[model samples]
Target chain A: AQSVAQPEDQVNVAEGNPLTVKCTYSVSGNPYLFWYVQYPNRGLQFLLKYITGDNLVKGSYGFEAEFNKSQTSFHLKKPSALVSDSALYFCAVRDGKDIFGKGTRLHILP
Target chain B: GAGVSQTPSNKVTEKGKYVELRCDPISGHTALYWYRQSLGQGPEFLIYFQGTGAADDSGLPNDRFFAVRPEGSVSTLKIQRTERGDSAVYLCASSPGVGPLYGYTFGSGTRLTVV
Candidate 1:
């Protein structure tokens, strides 16, 4: 079965420090990877996606993701963290349908 | 400027009752999708519609759940014999076509509570 995995349940980062939220996926054929962020009581906001051509995909809020074919990882990264960046991060893969990861709660400390 | 719209931002229904959740996708977006998000979990796919046809619905938990998009724009998800296990936030999203990296829009979603 196709699936996406976010091993980290929660990740904490001090303000202005680089942050990384790990994600890995398993799917047949070419993989379509995506990252999304959800705030409390709101719907998910689109972050970034990796389809083809580039391994490094940049997305909203100064966030970027590196898609690794051999490792099957598409980890989300940010050069610097902000308090507002704290939220639930979801990794999704588009197979026949979109399969999402369990989600990772990111906390940015002051 | 209008994003995907889901009606009844919150719904509370008793178990064994019937409930309907509605979604209106963005104008000219031909691919519409429905997902269910449980507490502390990511959204799970429920179904997808391309134009007026259901392209995929393999993720629906059971036969009690159904959806329709006769006009190819506004879709309604109907649940029969709702159970407490059915409680979740039903989310709706749309894109221009199948699996595009861009133009996917999501709605606030309807929080369905089954008592």
Candidate 2:
């Protein structure tokens, strides 16, 4: 079955430090990868997506993701973290339907 | 509306009761989707509608779960004999189409608590 995997349940990073939330996927055809963030009690907000072009896709709020076809991974990254960036992150892949991975909670410490 | 909208931001219902959660997609969006998100988990696909027809509903767990988008705009997800396991946040999203060009815009969601 087509699926996306977020290996980390929680990731902690000191404010201003670089942060990375890992994700991997298993699908048959060319993958359409996307990243979404959810704040407490709020709906998910789109961050970035990777369809076919460049591997590095930048998105809202200084967020970007690197799509590695060889590794079947689309990891979300940020150059510098902020306390407001702490939220739940989800990695999704579009097969027939949009399949989401177990979310990873990111904590940006002060 | 400016974005997708879901009604009853929170619902606390007794188990075995039936409930309906509503979703109003963004104006002009042709594709609407429903998902369920449990505590500490990501949203799981439940159903998808395209222009008043159910394009895909294979993700719905059982027959008790049904949805309709009669006008291809507003949708209602109906769940019968609700159980404790059904307690989760029901999310509604919409996109221009099912193509890769557009990402989904999700609503705040309706938290259904079955007790």
The best candidate in terms of DockQ: 2
Candidate with the greatest TM-score versus the true structure: 2
The parts of candidate 1 lying over 4 Å away from their true place are none
lDDT of 2 at B36: 98
Q: What is the lDDT of residue B100 in candidate 2?
A: 81
Give the alpha carbon lDDT tens digit for every residue of B24-75 in model 1: 9999998999999998888889999999999999988999999999999999
Query: Which CAPRI quality tier does the interface of model 2 achieve?
Result: high
Q: Candidate 2 at A39: error in angstroms?
A: 0.7
Evaluated on the second chain alone, the candidates' TM-scores are: 0.96, 0.98
RMSD of 1: 1.1
- Deviating ranges (above 4 Å) for candidate 2: none
lDDT of 2 by residue, B1-115 (tens): 9999999999999999999999999999999999999988899999999889999999899999999999999999999999999999999999999878888999999999999
- The models' CA-based lDDT, in order, is 0.91, 0.95
TM value for model 2: 0.98
Worst 10-residue lDDT window, candidate 1 chain B: B96-105
